[model samples]
Target: MSLIQACVTAATTLLAVLIGGWLTVRTQDRLWRRDQERQWRDIRLNAYTDFIGAVREYVAFILNPAARITVVPRPRDPGDLMPFFDDVGSRYRERLESTKTALRLVAGRPEVVSVSAELVRQARLLAAARADSGVEALQADRFDALWEAERRFIETARADLGLPSAFVS
Candidate 1:
């Protein structure tokens, strides 16, 4: 049309393109942030699961005599369990430690890491008790303490991951 109208149309088109580009960049940036957060949560969840699994396996091996038989040859004498305990206990402890390290690396909350330490401590206690006095010395309170520690760790990890507590009972 006229020179003024042409300039006005061109300016309006330029403004619209600039605004559209800015909105597109903003939306993409938001989406990228959300995707990164989801990936982080998944990584944390995997780490938490691995740590808990290691704890459970270690505890089960220590507390359940039958489980030990499946892992290693059963000792003829109860007193002969020392060697077995040393071997298996160290392996389990290593697994626990590695998993704990992974959890600590990914954990965003301090409580989860603290609770995991408590769980590891309880597992060690149970292993020590079993080693010193055999299964007979294994007390209900010791088992309860270990279980409670594990539960606390699970709850703390779940909260950190924004998941609802599954062990409310």
Candidate 2:
């Protein structure tokens, strides 16, 4: 072939290769994004379930701290706190799995890590609050601090996910 024709053929092949590469990348990228969104939703759901359940447990425990600690020393009884434990435990496990999946999908987004850490912190605080119950905890700052932390977490979650305050768990 002539020199000009050879150059034209080479350019065409190069263009075709580039276009094919771009198409493949686009398709993969789209699929990845879709999957990332799915994972985000799943993690959020799990986080909500466990986190909200924990919050409800705290509220109930607070309503009658005397009954929970004094009247019924076995606060973990099914009628009082056992069920909450089960719910929180199951939900937390689910949340953990979903979080790992999301991290894999998003490749370690810092916000997610921070949120997860806060979730742990909140759980620990609640557990601590439960430990100091009845009259001993009536004016304890631990419970208040825990409540404040939870409120902050809810607000942060809302701001990040654009969910309403009611969506907080």
Candidate 3:
């Protein structure tokens, strides 16, 4: 081959190597990003589920007839429940707080944080309602509002995590 032809062949080979390397890197970067997104979505799902579960447990304790009685060791007698109140309240409160902290660590969007705060607020309202009236009052008046807040939180978290919503037609 001519010297000029040999140089041209080498230049073409170098160019092909560079282009192939760039494409490979670009494809790998895209795959990495997709994997990261999926991992993040899973974390958000776990956190959100935990937070809701804690909230439900709290509400259940409030609505439980036994919660109204005051006594230590949690009276087995259905009539004596006052002592169980403080323990149940604090235990569920800790669970809710722990879940919220986990969510704060994993949440990528500000709206999810905001909605989580709303969920906490609504759950507190249910607790307060139970205190003011009775379990019957919570079922009557406060349950709907708490349900709505929880629904909003779930929807917002799903959107933030890029999960598809059944509500979207």
Question: Candidate 3: which pairs clash?
Answer: 69-81, 69-82, 70-81, 70-82, 70-83, 71-82, 71-83
Q: For this target, which candidate reaches the highest lDDT against the unseen true structure? A: 1
Clashes of 3: 7
lDDT of 1 by residue, 1-169 (tens): 8999999999999999999999999999999999999999999999999998998888777866643322232355333222234555667768888999999999989998899988887776677667655676689998999889988988898899898988847
TM-score, cand. 3: 0.83
Candidate 2: Cα lDDT at 98: 58
The candidate 3 region of ten consecutive residues with least summed lDDT is 74-83
Error of 2 at 155 (Å): 1.6
lDDT for predicted candidate 2 compared with the true structure: 0.55
| C-alpha TM-score for every candidate | 0.83, 0.46, 0.83
Pairs in steric clash, model 2? 52-169
lDDT of 1: 0.80
lDDT of each: 0.80, 0.55, 0.77
Off by over 4 Å in 3: 68-85
Question: When superposed on Cα atoms, how far off is each prediction in RMSD?
Answer: 7.0, 8.4, 7.3
Q: Could you give the candidate ranking by lDDT, starting with the highest? A: 1, 3, 2
Per-residue lDDT over 60-145 for candidate 2, one digit per residue giving the tens place of the 0 to 100 score? 54444443321223344233222133443445435544554554343323564465455444544454445455435445575566
